[model samples]
Target chain A: MDDILLMLPGPTTVHPRVLNAMSQAVVNHRSKRYGEILTETNELMSKMFQTENQSYLITGSGTAVMEAGISNVLNAGEKVLNVVGGKFGERFKKIADAHGIKTQELAVEWGTAVTPEQIKEALDADESIKAVSVVHNETSTGVAAPIKEIGKVMKNYDALYIVDTVSSLCGDEVDVDKYNIDVCVTGSQKCIAAPPGMAAITYSDDAWAACENVDSHTFYLDMKAYRKSGNKDPAETPYTPSVSLTYAMNEALKMIDEEGLDKRVARHHKAANATVAAAKALGLELFADEKVSSATVTALKIPEGLTDSDFRGTIRDEFGVELAGGQDHLKGNVFRIGHMGNISYKELFQTFAAMGIYLERNGIVEDGAAGVSSLVKSYL
Target chain B: MDDILLMLPGPTTVHPRVLNAMSQAVVNHRSKRYGEILTETNELMSKMFQTENQSYLITGSGTAVMEAGISNVLNAGEKVLNVVGGKFGERFKKIADAHGIKTQELAVEWGTAVTPEQIKEALDADESIKAVSVVHNETSTGVAAPIKEIGKVMKNYDALYIVDTVSSLCGDEVDVDKYNIDVCVTGSQKCIAAPPGMAAITYSDDAWAACENVDSHTFYLDMKAYRKSGNKDPAETPYTPSVSLTYAMNEALKMIDEEGLDKRVARHHKAANATVAAAKALGLELFADEKVSSATVTALKIPEGLTDSDFRGTIRDEFGVELAGGQDHLKGNVFRIGHMGNISYKELFQTFAAMGIYLERNGIVEDGAAGVSSLVKSYL
Candidate 1:
């Protein structure tokens, strides 16, 4: 019943403009105007992906794109190299394993990042591996993998680098072109600041070529099916696309362009620095390695006297802050604070202040000092 | 832009209440409300299918369902029986073939109905067929295949029957249980009048059993994956759902309950008859066989003096009434008018009147008086 502030990795805080875009009267999907919108959107999406390669806009979640990314082109007998570190990395391996695809995993420690050398070693070790999959940003532990490094390693090994940039694309800089990613996919609700309904995927020509050579014969998630039907007439997908959601994405993209990519990235960095600084001042240990910690979500360790679940539960129930708790092995050990989408100094400061209130009220932390010293310093 | 009526089959018209529902702040996909909604929507969807078996809601167009339906269930070497009668029927066959399913096709004349005898004959001859595929309503040629009759024949056969009911589900009537359907699929934008972001699919226990026995590996669209994840957490799916679209469907389902299903179906029948009668009076012949004519889209023969493109062009440009032209091999031969979704008699009559004006202006008809008279009398 009360207003809730979402500081979880995504469906993050949707901007007012993006929500307002959905308020327009719904339009017919087959119309020329709608086609023009789809066409223009494809153009804009290409710019965002930093590639001239054709990008697909799927009206499903980021996971849907991940499914399509693998199943559409890969045959049942082929093998994929999964880079496993945290939740998303495990997710890629699990999804591939579910598809009966043979997986060669290069496992990284939970809080540590996966190195390019690991990917190269795996590729060198397994000549059967066709695609090397990794998450650019793992929301689970605030780790951002070195995509450029992995991409280079993949290039020398003749393997495709399929990156899950769901929590990182537009959060920090993703030089998709420079990185030479075969498939870089993202969801709308992350740094885009739009309500989630769509997932945008940019595929390199090699990836399209892979889709062409793919013998899996998938139907709904078939990129070839979409390509065959969509390219034929009037800028439409093989299936009916979500028109209202497309409108929201278009408006969100405009705002991104207006602010400029460099400025937006800089804004996120500023927020990350402020929040991390506040955490340090309060003697709260950072969960991820500082060098690779995500600008979008910061995983923080629970203080000596507090449990993660109880700490997060009180904040959510009382102060109405929705922070995401750690998953898998990290459960009850860490909590993530999302600074993605439309966030500001005032919002983060409020969160810090609220944490101070709850920790003090519950006798978890020593009295009011957290607010006076830790919370205010983030603004300064 | 001026308010325009949607006369296309699938993405027809969205109800205002549904649009309002989608515009509300999105709820967390993992929330209690979200779980209750996912479960309740599937339950209501089961009622539409007339089956007790659980169904999955997907965020994509009708094609996505068609593709996921085939690719995610049947293996590469499996066999399927396809009954091709209209555009959608042919599409089902193509999707099946793309998945490398060995297909036994019973080709019926376009705009004509298929006989149960044909299906029985096909099944009697080909015992290797694993499943039977057909479309309940073929939007392209305005033909509604006799699904109930087909179900009777399929019940006696060894193969499961999968029906593409994208345009017919909430418009006319579908007793998915009573009809003994295995897979019954529909889109969000059809009779439900939700936006074009979601696809609804119901699987009979037989279908579920088939899916379980089959070697399905497509992760995201695998119904079993949805079943395991959605069933595991009462309110959760394996992946993120289109939160706003689900909210929109909830509102639309309430409207369906308010206007009883039978009453709503009767409305469609009345509109169909009115449209056909009006077309006849204007010296235009119905493209579909009378017995099989659909209650949704009505395809009409382009008058001898007019081409399909010219007539459609005149209607959209001169009268602000857009109509669908024939595609593929049927181009320039017929134009279709859809009367599905949340259309009223006023809108239907206006479309008919506008078509008359366009015909008169194009010299296809001597006057608009006969068309207007027929439309009015048919309504009475």
Candidate 2:
């Protein structure tokens, strides 16, 4: 089968070097070289996260780290305010519930961003709330909440601030310290341009202290153990990690380093802009508010005549381009185009061309050429 | 740096094709092709485990699945009998402790196998025990417990039988149904010859029934959620998995398939026999009882004059062969040579040559060539 272009939220398109690195010979987890790889990957992740705080790699999907971030700090029966705008926001509440953490759901309409004022009001109403969880980028709706302002509001309160930057971390700017984020979690498969396997997490002293007070933890995902072992002379995970994935992540981080964070962010922004412009030019309505649309994935409403499966399947089956369909409630109503990671302007233009052809083939659009030209124009 | 031959119990040498497979383009977790990969991998793993029951793939290290196997069956406050013969055995107790399960430790001396009679006596003594956890291969001591007989003993009782085959599953024969194992867990990097990231677990109907009665599970490692989602038409993990590792595992399993299980097991046994024979020829004593020494890793006592680090480090630094030093109490007292997965007879011969040189350099053995010749003779 021909290689299909991945334009999903994650696992993103892995760089060739990163993919090749995954195929390297397995190394001892305790070896000096392996430790160096772990340390270097952690260091690079810290830089990518834009924080001096220590970052640890965990051998699981971003959701595992998300659970770890919340479970480690939010004790059972303790109140936490969860700001929900989309599917990921609801997931935060579910994870907290699974851990026995009491949560007050601050739900906004889907495809809309939550405000700092709303969070401040929730905190003000519940002085006993121990933490606040928010998603920086809700992949389900392509909406990125205003974390910087929410962090400011959280500062005035005693609640530990936690953010899930799984889909937004590298594509967009997220200054951990500036945002006063106590726990920042991201996955390797997103903007890091690595295959899915590990999630990188950074924690502040407060988050660690909160963990210290907890009586029990899931041993496999224990944050304190990871922090201790990961900070050793030569860094190492407390348990056997996904060694191949770590190698891939190292190569991915190297690519990110070479591209430079600012340029990478700008590149993602440009691609996202072009995609949105092309979608609009094709007479499609953007699902997310223009101001808050994520720089990683763009959600567009399904055309009246086209079913989500027909549209996506045609693009995938005919063009060999894999675009993400909306998740859960948004399924069949919206489609998403991911522009993060190793995707470029050329790929975006090609994806748009595929989208246009699908639309024209389905009799939804009169001229496919018009959409392709508009996409090329937007890319310029 | 050249690839160091991994002679550790795990993170073993990955085959070239397996590594190359990892570098393939990322696929959507929800896609049909991804589902086929998942289903195929699961099918292969079920074959490798010799179980007709369902097997699930987890994204974390083997330790994660170990925890999952135990926690899923044993409820909090439930009593479990753990047979401890070495480091990994002791870990079973610790994992149970972490999950609030009361464990009765049936400890045997290190470097010795636990007999079925001992397990039977323990089970007879404890009628309240809900489950029994045992390590099939004690990697730290290179001892393989008598699981087939122990499984028979477990059948007399109501306790669910669980086996940790992290280091022995494919290298050694383990028939889950024949052994009546309720939960069997193993890692990808061991005998499977894939890079670490995932653990494969098989559960019987009895184990599933036990899980149905338990409330409140660690969400990320929740077995039921994984089973449901993983068994769907288009198989998918509840969370994003280590897709790269899965691809590597698929390729590794394909290699195993081509070789045939009997041949693979025979190869491992031959290599282990040669390693042990060569060590004896060099005047080094085997750590485990010869009757129960594992076919995957062979532990050998450190000679009085040579420290473990110096001996293993010299072999690693000078010969680029990474051997594992003894873990925990056996540290600086024993070193292990792994002969599992993709390791060939030639590589084993080379490893013995390196060990012979290290012994001669340390003045522990005279005429290093004598040991290498013995290894080659034994291979013949």
In candidate 1, which residue ranges exceed 4 Å CA deviation?
Answer: A98-100, A228-234, A303-309, A368-375, B71-73
Q: Which stretches in model 2 have alpha-carbon errors above 4 Å?
A: none
Candidate 1: TM-score, chain B only = 0.96
lDDT of 1 by residue, A294-379 (tens): 88889999877788768887888888888888888888888889898788777787788778787777776675366446546655
Estimated TM-score for each candidate:
0.95, 0.98
**CA lDDT for candidate 1:** 0.79
- Candidate 1 has an interface RMSD (Å) of 2.1
For candidate 1, write residues B322-355 as lDDT tens digits: 6788866778888888888787688777787888
Clashing pairs in 1: A219-B67, A220-B67, A220-B68, B35-B235, B49-B176, B50-B177
Q: Provide DockQ values for all models, in the order shown.
A: 0.57, 0.76
Local distance difference test scores for all models: 0.79, 0.88
- lDDT for each residue of candidate 2 in B1-380, tens digit (9 for 90 to 100): 44688888988887778877887888888889889999999999999999898889999988899999998888889999999888888888988898888999998999899898988888787789899999999999999998999988988888999999998987998999999999999999899988888999999999999999986458888899989998898788889998878888899898999999989999888888888888889998999999999999999889998777777878888898998988888889988888888887788778888987877876878888777898768867
Ten contiguous residues minimizing lDDT sum, candidate 1 chain A? A367-376
After the best TM-score superposition of candidate 2, give how far the Cα of residue B315 lies from its true spot, in angstroms: 1.2
Query: What's the C-alpha lDDT at position B209 in model 1?
Result: 77
